[model samples]
Structures are given as C-alpha cells and as structure tokens.
Target: MSGTELTVTLSGATAADARAVVRVLEPAFGQAKEEPPTSEDVTVHTARFEHDPADRAAEPAAGGPGHLSGAVTVTVQGAPEAVSMARESLAHAFTAQDQGSVSGDQEQEWQLLLEP
Candidate 1:
C-alpha cells in the first residue's frame, strides 16, 4: 500500500527498553528477506538501531524504574498504516510496563522518549 513515510525515534532508552522496543517492532517489521517467513502482518521500510557499547556498562541494571545516562535510539520508517500499527503496539508495551512515553510530531516525524 502507498502512504506517507514516517520515522519514529526512541531516545533516552536503556538496554531493557531497547529489547522491549524490538519485541514490539518485530511483529510490524517482520524478518529479513533472507529469513523464513513468519507471522508478521506489516513490513517495515527501514529500521535502524543506535547505541554506544561504552554507555552500556554505565547503564543501571534492568529492574524497577531504570535511569538513563545514555540513549539507544531505534528508528523505524514505514507506510502510514504500518506506522500507526507500530505506534499502537508501542503504546501498549510501555503502558503494560507502567512506563510512559512522551511523543511529539514534527514534519511527519514522531519522536518517543522513554525512561530507563
């Protein structure tokens, strides 16, 4: 399907947060073309992971409300419909964990801020 392309970026994330984000995105993005087919419903146009290994050591251990000394930004771009689906999935994820996400829209780009 044809739709506006959009990017979602998550900032101030911990390794745990990163893992959570992937769990939510994987269903929307699906496996690489080389991989066997799975139960994904949407296909992502692009996905990128950003993080620094040096900062990993400094991050607080996963559990309870975590703190962020650094960030792991995961960006995903896809059609509007797919992006919307991803957003809903993401919302459910954070809500389930009692974590809150601050989102803003600017020039069709959506940014999500996560704690811990």
Candidate 2:
C-alpha cells in the first residue's frame, strides 16, 4: 500500500452494514478499490483508499447518515494522518466510540465501534 493509503476493515456486522460505513467515507477519501459486498453472510469486509493530498485542503463533504443493523467494529490502518482523517470522517457520519489505537514508526491503526 502507498504511504497515503488507508485500509478499512469492518467486522462484527453484516455485509450491508459494512457497505453503509463505506458510503459514509466515500466523500472524504474518494472511491474505495473494493466493490460493495455481494453476500449478506459475510461479517467482515475491507476497503482500500488512496488519499489525495489535495483532498486534505478541501472541505470534507457532508455525508448523509448511514444505517447499521448492529454495532460494527471498524479498524482503519494507514499513515498517521490518513488514519486520523478517516477517523474524523467516520465520526461525522456515525455514532462512533473509540476502541483504542496502536501506532508504529510510520503507520497507525485506530479502532472504533460504530452504531446506527
């Protein structure tokens, strides 16, 4: 992955719920490389996004609210700034509770519990 790339792993929810979270992030990070999940049975879904530096200067798009069938655990891993930006984007669109984080020399991983 690129230094400016973010990988979002969503679990503890259905595929639809995971896609809902992705929809909320699309405006902030541009389109994700993964397509929407095709099976409802899947409880985990992953999406990858490459951050555009210019996006940091622009106003974050006001994403509409998303629906979740149940609480979802979202983990965002990437460069520190990229992870922070994704956290902010998710906060704006969901009821997110911090679930701790871990950081390395060049990357950061943040986890959150999201609800409808």
Candidate 3:
C-alpha cells in the first residue's frame, strides 16, 4: 500500500458491525474498497482506504448513528501518519481503547478495541 493508504481489518464481529465501523471512517478518508464478508460464518472483514492530504476537509465528519452488537477488534495498517489519522477518526466515532502497536521503518500497525 502507498503511504496514504490504510488497510482496516475488523474481526470477531458480524458483517453489519464491520460496515458500521467503515461508515465512521468514510468521511475522513473518502470512499474505501470494502470487502464484504464471504459467508455467514465469516468473522473478518476488510477495507482499503486511500487518504488524500490535499483533499482533506477542514473538519472531519462525525460518525453515523449505526450501532454494533458488541465490541469489535480493529486492526489498522499503513504508514505511521495514516495509521494515526485513522486512529483519531475511530476515536471520534466509538469508545476506543488503545491495545498496542508495532512500528517499522516504512509502516505501522495499530490495534484498537471499539465499543458502541
């Protein structure tokens, strides 16, 4: 992925719950390539977002009123700045707890637990 691209992974949640989280992030990063859950038994959903710094809105949009059944584990992977921006966006939408994160030379991975 590019520096401005972020990959969001949601696990231990239903498809609807995953979509709710993606909706919260759409405004900050624009539309994302969302991968629908493969089957009813599937527990993981993924979305890819490309953030354009030049086109960012002055004020990020607030998350919608969609509700989740339970807490969702979210994993965001991207460049350091991209991951940070995504974390901030998720915080504005849900009750997020910082789990932990790992950083490398060109990329970073952050894990968060989000509650409705």
Specify the highest-lDDT model's number.
Answer: 2
Off by over 4 Å in 2: 1-3, 55-60
lDDT of 2 at 46: 90
Task: Identify the candidate with maximal TM-score.
Answer: 2
- Show where candidate 1 strays beyond 4 Å: 1-8, 32-46, 49-76, 96-107
Tell me how far the alpha carbon of residue 20 in candidate 3 is from the true structure, in angstroms, after superposition.
0.5
lDDT of each: 0.40, 0.84, 0.81
Lowest summed-lDDT stretch of 10 residues in model 3?
57-66
TM-scores of all candidate predictions against the true structure: 0.42, 0.89, 0.85
Collision pairs in model 1: none
Give one clash count per candidate, in the order shown.
Answer: 0, 0, 0
Superposition error at 36 for model 2 (Å): 1.4
lDDT tens digits, residues 1-116, model 3? Answer: 23378899998888888878788888888878755454657778888988776776645566655478899999999978778888888887888899999999989999999887
What's the C-alpha lDDT at position 59 in model 1?
Answer: 26
Ranking by lDDT: 2, 3, 1
Q: What lDDT score is found at residue 41 in candidate 1?
A: 40
- Measured with C-alpha atoms, the lDDT of residue 115 in candidate 1 is 34
